[model samples]
Target: MDRPSSPAAPAAQNPVQLYGSFHLGEFELALPIDALQEVVTFPDAIARMPLAPAHLLGMFTLRGLLIPIVHLGSFLGLPNGTDHSEARIAVIASGDMRLGVLFDRTGEILRVSTGQIVPLRHGSESLGLIESAFHLGQRILQVLSADVLSRLPGLPHVLNPDLAQQASQRRMAQGSRHQAISFQVGGRPMALPMEAIHEIVRFPVLEHSVLADSRCRGWLQLRGRPVPVVDFASFLGLESCSTEAADGSDSEDLRRVMVLRRDDSYLGLLVDEVDSIVAYLGAQLLPMPAIRGQAGLFAGCISRCDTGAHDLILVSAPALLAEPYMAELAKGHHDLYLVADDELRDVETTRQRARETWVTFHLDRLMGLRIEQLCEVIDYDPTLVRPPGAPSHVRGVLNLRQTLITVIDLRSLYSMKEAEDLAASKILIVEHGGYKYGLVVDAVQNIVNIERAEKLRVPAMVANQLDTELRQDLREIVDLPDQTTIMLLDSVPLMQRLTGNGGGSTVVAALPERVVGQA
Candidate 1:
């Protein structure tokens, strides 16, 4: 595989998460990006199986592999979306079963945050395959667990022992088990690892702050000290649970603040209500794919109760307060009360700051790329050129001042449909190892400055669960105060996809004198 000329960046502090979104009529659904292998047109030949369920569409040949086809609409009792020409097959692999699900059309690849996912309500028990659901604007998208589908009663076989063993080992590793404090926000259950929590305090004297971080909801007085408080709902990028009623008046009063302490510094998180402290097994916590344009607030998903209870999203306290701006705000609050007395004089007060910038843009939705690998953003019409034998991702080529640049469709690279209605779009001129290319995107948003401390390394297990294409190229995610997540795209694997250096079809610009040879 071809590597970028730029020095490799340090490991990401957060996991880069994404999921594939598709449609069944007007209903939208999502599957873990790792669970899906590819999206392809319906096979030309499909053989029916004897004694198979109605949901079983049949079997087909794909790249020399036998894949069973499933009618997802029939299984879910929704309108079948496969009658149209735009219908496509979503290839899924779970343990031993490799199946294809029929969908009306494939949508954008979502950069999903773990916190954005919520468990299905009580009445949704009828939707067997849906593990959880998430809100996308006014619409809610059901999250389908392909593994569960593979194990359905009517399925022909069982999971491979080797694959099942590997999955079991991953969930039960040492330190995976931990006690957590569970609470509710916006009527949804959430938890935090008890280790990061200092104490739970109710009805602490509160005062509004005029000069704290924007994300800070207010300040709380505790132990003769001031702690900056942030609304837990807003901090997690959700609508305020305490919203105005139809009469345009606020409903509930602020309930309690969870005081979290990291060393001498302290921060308070205002929540809707506090529940209970429970010891949770790591095996019970599942990695959740996040929604695009949001930050990860929850570490993972937890379903404690089995009696029609919803899944609880586990909050990562350290990462929440790890933002440099939040840290600095806490320091300022701490220093205001720290006197030069013999008891307090020994404490260190020196502070330093580290920040990183990114070139932000919109693909199918909000996305970002590090400035290090980006050359420039330009406006160009790619319909001018079409090359012979180019891969699907390669739209064509562009000549900028006589330098040949390969223009690739970001949507296609991300396994999304082409944006035909988008008459105009921006091209991101990016470079890797002196090889330059133009990435076509929906639009160029802006430049953003972020604190380095806020970035967290995505857990190894989470990365392992993702498909190779995404797991390798997408390694980091940053959540903004507004509750949007920006993915940091790695250029190395991206260039390899275009150059065919990683055992795939390569798209090379035809130049008078080839400036860079194909890898």
Candidate 2:
């Protein structure tokens, strides 16, 4: 056999290059590393691009720049990428057009040389976009043409003046359509116009207000200013779709609050939960029904959801957020200030006018504390340290973030029956004199809003179990719609009685330096 001749040496100028690779459907593909700009996770909201072909996913903001996501699978004749958590958008910039390609997941950056790149046979189909392939042991990787891939079909084919003008006109016609957010109120589906909405937020801690209207729920001090919260169901004259059990019991789960814009002011619309944002064509909306008094609340009805499920009642933004409602809210404040000086006012009168919100918890039966006085809530820790000669009420000192938080057992403090398993119990932190104390309870429940009209004075029977100081902490008793009664406790007096010995302050000193900012 003849010996094979040695391979000829090439010029030193052409060096191997690196390519960024990622899994596309069943196959792995590579693009020039220099062409790859970034890899970003999917955004929360991607604006739908009108008139764009299926291959063009949508427009998403990447580092403040709006970039388009291209469905690489569709372009390759494979199934389009689904909304999998592992899916990522690989941004590729080509000239003036910057876009992203969807992929299953990223792969390793591989180094390859021109000599190793095996050109496919002319008859073999490696999609026109795949210029060549590289053999790596048993696997073959297809290198995509970055230039041709960036120019997605249906995008400007020719830089003609007429084509650009037509695209601009199409976008302008689609801009005026309404975008609305759908949500559940009292189990009923409803929608608020996108133009009238400011933002959707998690239920925030609302400061109890005696001056605000009951229908308004209460006032939330947002960003140093008070924003009134409206009960969407109540405003619509529907049955309360409160999250708590029908009996007006307490719950700790967060609700969805939709902040809405009314002129220059903002209002928080409390709903059961928000569903999704959907766009509607003008012709899809049915004419508003003229109900005797409800004409102002309903703008139109959306016959079906995008899935053709339930019907959606469109809330008239202009009417729901009318000047008359604001006038009524303003009148409530004026009336409250008028009677502010009367300290000896009848309880019946206050109950009939004011609304109170309580943070309920359970020791044995349902119990509550005034929401206004609550500073914060923390989870209970089982590893709390017991100090020597601690009282029955003073269970132990908890090292919460290095702050020595004195935990008070509500059951022991009130001489009530304790639960066999206190593992799920929570600590309610109340602040007084710059010190914080933890009140341990069985379970934190829901927040219930009660009409002052429904509140009753604490009965003498329940009051007899406590000494005068503790008895004074009993705020009132209110009957829930579910026929259950909740005994409301006042936090200020309770905190004072629990920490009168300066024990909370002493506990703070005993805590390690790490807990200084535990609050």
Candidate 3:
């Protein structure tokens, strides 16, 4: 390994650092070391940004934002060596700007320059970072500038959304990010992003009341507030390291409580041990060493273990919480039970609207559309028109999206005289057919997911009772809470009719029906 020359003991002191020697292939360029930040091991990342400087080797991301990685050697007419990983990125900063310049491996930091310098005649020369030429013993070093490197040609381009997408995908696949938060679960090490953890609590002695039924640690008084603690081992479906439960002693077993904030929920994760923050470097990891029974619980492991270091397996938290035990634990718990499903979670939450809409009702003792559909429940607003010459079931016209839609009283059409309760007659504002419509219900109630299997054929026996015209559209018979099968109204044909026509406002009585198994 060839090293750069050590700094001369300066009876004369210049701390700004003059000669920052970086090897471009075999040749040396004198850069100002004081301007240089620490050299970091550059990971192999994808470059997708366009209109990049010729010096840049495509574009890459640093710290989640898009930043380009430039190939100094390629631009400087130096030999094209191996990839950037074999090289190190020498970070240089000037004033408010910073950039990482690539090198074929790292060379020594030498301080040497001519008070008055020279130039090379072999290649086409550039004026910027390769400032002026100077001489060391047996070598010529061209002085480089950190400032000029950043401001080279076409360096001020903004990020392209499409290129950002490609780079993000490439980052995940390559595991290029090195920084990670690590800990121990069941004596096995695991690591994740430090950004993921809110705070870590040490050795929380979960009361039997909390863990007995709820995976939640009985709310511990943290700053006078009850914070939910999750048993990490149990939640991950991994076996606990120790079988003994806490006995309410002031002194308890050591466990780490990791507070995690998801979109709509905040929960605690209980771990057997906690380790120091580590740099994962996107290395490959294993879940468990051996497939012992339910060994699939672990994600994967890192091949090389550095003493206290081990590759950490990242667990999918939502999948673990979805276990049958979650519902059981949530039973009787004060808080309403809801899955912290990231996939299902809406980025832009609408709680008031969501609550109002997701509600259920009954018409003739049968389930109406889901409760969540009713954006509002109020006395019939007479200001909205009542469509004329419709049917007995068509109660009136309601204004939705500046259009009049015939409001249907579902119970009357089904001929369930017992279903019509005057006090329970309320207007429901439903969103469908690319517009909003209103329904007059006999009774309104809590909304729930109608749990039903698919492709239900209303058997030949009950076929006569359903709509002879719209029979094909009834795809499934979902049994609701009241145990009566509610029909899932097919909205596609209705939407098409409403949108296809002028201002598309009305639900046509007769239209093409839904094929069975459509859902």
Candidate 1 global lDDT? 0.63
lDDT string for model 2 (170-240, tens) is 54564544556677887898888755665555566666667556567776643333567778778777776
Expressed as tens digits, the lDDT of each residue in 157-197 for candidate 1 is: 64456655664465466226555656677677887775566
Candidate 2 runs further than 4 Å off: 1-193, 196-353, 466-470, 501-519
TM-score of each model, in listed order: 0.31, 0.38, 0.29
For model 2, what is the alpha-carbon lDDT of residue 457?
A: 87
Question: If the candidates were sorted by their TM-score against the true structure, best first, what order would they fall in?
Answer: 2, 1, 3
Kindly give the stretch of ten consecutive residues in candidate 3 with the minimal lDDT sum. 510-519
User: Model 3 over residues 1-519: C-alpha lDDT tens digits?
Assistant: 012122233212322233445556756665565566445456565564576655666555554545556777555446655555456666666664556777654333343323224432221222345555653433445666666687777664455667667856866886865434466776677754444554555544554453443345554433222346666666555776453434446543546666554433445567775544343445455445645543434455654444333446765444433445443443333244333323222421322123211244555444445333333455555565444445556566654333455565555544546442466477775555334445676666553443334326567767667664344434446554465566555534433443345355434443222210011
lDDT of each: 0.63, 0.63, 0.50
For model 1 the TM-score comes to 0.31
Model 2 scores a TM of: 0.38
lDDT of 3: 0.50
What's the CA RMSD for each of the models?
24.0, 25.4, 26.8
